[model samples]
Target: MIKKVLSFAVIGVSTVTLAIGLSPNTASAALGDQPEVFHSSYNPGKSTVTISTSNTEKKPVKASGYLSKYFKGYAHKAKNGKWQFHLDGYGDAEGLYNNVRNDQTVRVYLSEGKEQGAFDVKVKTIVKKNKVKKKKAIKISKAINGKNVKIKNNKRKSDVITIKKVSKNDKITIYNAKGKRLVQKTAKGNTIKIYVRQLGKKAGAVNVSTQKKGYKESGKIKVKYGRE
Candidate 1:
C-alpha cells in the first residue's frame, strides 16, 4: 500500500529540501561572490608587501594575512581594491624586514571571510654591493689643435689619435687593415701617436682598441687615413 501511494502533495518540497539544508550542488560559491588575487609583490627596501585582489561582490570586506613566519597583520584596502601591507619597524613590526633577503621567496597567506588564498612571492633583488654601473661605450678621440676631441676627419693622415675614458695603466693596441698587430703600448695620456704610414697607403684601415688592466679589450675601431 505504501509503495502504491503516489498521492499529490503541496509544491513545498523544494522549500522543505531547503529547510533540511540540501543546497544544490550547482549553487554559487560564497553566494556567487569569490575573492581573487591578481598581483602581488614584496619590496625589501620599504618593508612593504602589496597585492591587487578582488571581492567578487559589491560589499567591501577586510582582509587578514601573514607573510610566512615573519608576522601576522591586516592589510589596508583601497577603494579600488588594492591592498598594501606595510611592516615598517614599529612595535610588533620591528625586524619584519631584517630577516628578508634580496630575491628570496616567501609564502603569503590571506583570507577574507569564506574566501582565502595563499601563494609565494619573491623579494626583488637589490644588492647594493653587487650592482655595477655600466660604463659608456669608449669612443676613440683625437688631438685637434692640442685639444682632445672626437676625430672629425676620419680620412686624414694624422699619426696620432686621442684616447679618452681610459686609465694610464690601460694598454692601447693598434692593428693593420689585414688584422696584423702593428704597435701596442701603455696609454700615456689623452693623446698618443701612432705610425699612420704603417698602412702604406693601400686603402688599409688602422684599427685601435684599449684593454683595462685585467678586463677584456674594447672593440677595435677603424681610423685609418685614405690613400696618399
Candidate 2:
C-alpha cells in the first residue's frame, strides 16, 4: 500500500507540470522582459504629433499624459510592418502650458491593450506664433463703381449691407431708382455695416455710393432688391 501511494503522488506532480507547460498564459509570461519601442515628433504649423512604434502588434496603443490632454491620439499599422500613432491638435498645448512661449518639454505615456505597464517618451518641441495680416483700406470710388458691397437682404425684415476695406468717416448712401435718398451712414471703422429698412417693400433697382476725405464722390453701384 505504501508503494502504491508514492506512485500516485509522483504521477500527479508530473501531470501538473505538463499542464503548466502547455498553458498559453504561462508561455506569455516568459516574454514579459520585452517592451515596445517608439519615436515621436511634433509639428507646430500643422498642430500634429506623430509616433512610430517598432512593434507590429495588432493591438491598439493609446497615448496619455501632460501633452495628451491637448491632442487626440490613435494607433494603426503602417505599410512598413510597424505601428503608427497620430496625435492631432498639438498646437492647443500652448493653452495647457501657458508659460511656455517658444519651446516646451512634454511627457507622453503609451500603452497597449489592457496592459498595466506603459512606455514613457519625453519630447521637446518648438511652438510658433501665428501672424495675422491687416486688411488694407478699399478704394472708395473703385468699390462703389465696381459694386463691391456685400449685401445680406432680408425679405420680411431689415437688410444688412456690409462695405469692406472702408475707412473711418467714410459716408455710405443708399438711393432708390428715382434718386431719392433712402438711408445714409458714416463708417466708424475699417468696415461699415448698414441695416436698410427704409425701402419698405419697394423692389426696384437701388444704388449705393460712398464719400471719403481724400477720395472723389464715388460712382453709383446698382443694387438689386432682396439680393446679396
Candidate 3:
C-alpha cells in the first residue's frame, strides 16, 4: 500500500466584478424626439446609448465604452453583423482592443446602410457594480521520515499504520506505480492514518499526495514488510 504526508496553508478573498453595463444614467438615449429609434450601450462599465437619425429602421448602430475602476476585468460582444460597435478599453473574442478607455470618451460613430439624409442623434449612460471572490497563499508539503517501510506478520494480518502531519483539513491520496489508487482519505485533524496489507515480501516504493483547502502537497514512502 502507498501512504503520504503533507502540509498546506489556506487563504481566500472576496470581491465582485460585473461585465454587463446596465445603469440608469447609462441608459440608451436618442438624438431626436423619437421613441422606437435609439442606440445600444456597452457592458457593465458606463452604459451609454447614442442615436443619430430617427430613420424608422436605423440600419443598426453600434456603441462602445470603458468599464469601472473597481472591476477586475471586463469583456463584451455583439450579436451578428447588425451593428459594429468598438469600445476603446473593451476587448473582443479575438483579442484585446487597440485602445483603452481609462477616462477616455465613449466614441461612437454611425453610418446609414441605405438612407442618405439628415438623422437625429441620442446618447445616454448608465453605471453599475459587481463582486468577486478568490483563494490565495495555498501550499502543499510531503516529507517521509524514513526511506523504507516496516512490516510485522503476526498471522499474515493487515498492518494498520497512521500517517499524520501538522496540517488540518487536508486531502490525502495514495497511488501505485501504475497510477492505481490503493486508499484515498481526507484529513479531519492535522494528521491521518491508514491500514495496508502487510505482505512480508511485498515491500517497495509508492507515491503519496496531500492537499489542503487551498494548498497542495505530495511525497513518497517506501513500504518494508517482515520487520521486528
**Candidate 3 at 37: error in angstroms?**
19
Candidate 3 structure quality by residue, lDDT tens digits, 1-228: 222233444457444333454443333332222333233343212334333222112232344232221111222333762322333322221233322233334433222222222222224322223346677666656544443223344346665545645366666666565667777777777556656565234444445666657555656555434442
TM-score of every candidate relative to the true structure: 0.29, 0.33, 0.35
lDDT of 1 by residue, 83-194 (tens): 4433222233344432333455555443432323444544432212335899977654332222222332233554544555555667778777678887887867655544
lDDT (tens digit, per residue) of candidate 2 on 22-129 = 355554564453334333334211222333342112431223444344444444455896444443333433222211111233343323222223223333223223
lDDT of each: 0.45, 0.52, 0.41
Best TM-score among the predictions, by candidate number: 3
lDDT of residue 93 for candidate 2: 35
Those runs of model 1 whose alpha carbons end farther than 4 Å from true positions after fitting are: 1-158, 161-165
| lDDT score of residue 92 within candidate 3 | 26
Error of 3 at 76 (Å): 13
lDDT ranking of the models: 2, 1, 3
